[model samples]
Target: MESEALLSVRDLRIAFAGVEAVRGLSFDVRPREVLALVGESGAGKSLTARALLGMVPEDATTSGTVTLLGDTDLAAQRGLHIALVPQDALSALSPVHPVGDQLAAAVRSVARVSRKEARARAVAALDRVGIPDAARKARAYPHEYSGGMRQRAVIAMATVNEPDVLVADEPTTALDEERRDQVLRVLGEQREALGAALVLVTHDMDVVRDHADRVLVMYAGRLTELGPADAVLGRPRAPYTAGLLASLPEHDAPRRRRLPALPGTPPAPGTLPPGCAFAPRCPLAADLCHREEPEPQEVEGHLVACHHWAELPHPAVDLFQEKQHASS
Candidate 1:
């Protein structure tokens, strides 16, 4: 484990019924930094985030060490040391209980506090997340709160315990653009206030560009690129990362210009390609790429997993554009 890392994940693997969903993965989350885990759906972003909090499903088999502040027992430390903000706020919150009561229960579960103190802390947490009239609003049920408010309350609940790490799985999913930004702002504020490391899992590149200090790009359940946000997003070394960026509609491009899209879907678990799972979809894949899996290695300033990373084009998005043009 790195000396400065708040949480360290090494060789993390999750398999379901002998089918690997998340392959060998390693990373470190430093204190007070946002590390964005990004990839398309079925890339294991959510599974990886859940694993950080020891929340993987019962039937799945997991291997790896997720150490937090020198503690390897994640299940015991969950909520007290690490917390999760699940994707669906409505489902995560109980409709039967008042929001404040739920938060108060969470506080009391971890700390030996009186009901009064717990309620006070819960209200304070709600207020911290900018829930207007938190004292009154916290008394409302999940159904009574608006979508945005429910999301904020979930954030408040996750942070009220003052965990050292927070793993949010697509926190802004299904939210409108304005509401998404607002929720991210609230999440950032809570992270700042708690001085916690955040592992944010989302498919949103725009969110990654705006909020992440570092980006970890996954493909077919394995790391394709990992580096500082600017370096990774701006000059992605891996073809998989480049392809993903190329597919995004550029702001300065013509509104009707078709975006370059990666040709194939991600391979289903248990049916991955022999060498590199992405080789079939990667435009730059060479014979060696098809014959041998590339482990993540330092290239320029980033860790990229690709046999041909050194040969990737400058302004990496052009790599995919040229491929698209050739195919057309």
Candidate 2:
């Protein structure tokens, strides 16, 4: 583990019965940095986040070295050093308890604190997340708060202990545009306030483009590309990465009536075919891709697992420039 890394994962793999969910994953997150895991649903994004906090489902088996703050084994130090903002705050929170009481309980679980002191911390946390009338809101049960407010409260509880790492799984999911931005802003604010490293598991490329320092693109239980956000999103090296961006409605080139899309859906987890999991759908897949899984290799300093990455042409930048020009 590197001394500078707040969290380090090496060859992490998880399987349910004979089917793998995450395969040979490795990554590092430095303090105060945001690493986004962007991919379609069932791409192992949530599983990876859950595994980081030792919260994988009971039916699964996992193996990997997850180190936090250099020496702490993440499995042993789950909630004490790391916390999770689960996808659904409504279900994650105790519906019967006052939101404030729940936040205070979280603080108490991680540290020795008096009830009065914990309550104070909880209120402060709520205020930090921009909840109006924080003190009063604390007394309300989860059902009383609106969805956005509940989500903010969940973030507050997750960060109240000032954990070294925070895993936010689809924090903006199910929110309207306004609420999505609000949740994103609060997450960024909280991460900065605590100087905590964040692993944002989301399928929203826009979120990744705006907030992430780097990105890890997962496909079919394996990493297809991982690099700086600009390079991966703007000039994707792997065909899969390019396909994802091209398929976006907003990325359609001028006058292009139909949006481009990858040909096939992701393979079922346990039923993954013999070779590269993405080969079936990848436009640039070659014979090698179907027979031998491509290993992550250095491509201009970034990592991409593609047998034909060198052959894949970077998307034309002028297409976007023209769109911007016309819109302006």
Kindly state the number of residue pairs that clash in model 2.
0
Residue-level lDDT for 60 in candidate 2: 90
Root-mean-square deviation of Cα positions for candidate 2 versus the true structure, in angstroms = 4.1
Error of 1 at 159 (Å): 0.6
After the best TM-score superposition of candidate 1, give how far the Cα of residue 311 lies from its true spot, in angstroms: 0.9
Model 1 misplacement above 4 A: none
Clashes of 1: 0
Candidate lDDT (C-alpha), each = 0.92, 0.85
- TM-scores of the models, in the order given: 0.98, 0.92
Q: List RMSD in Å for every model shown.
A: 0.9, 4.1
Give candidate 2 misplaced runs (Cα > 4 Å).
1-3, 251-256, 316-328
Give the least accurate 10-residue stretch of model 2, judged by summed lDDT.
316-325
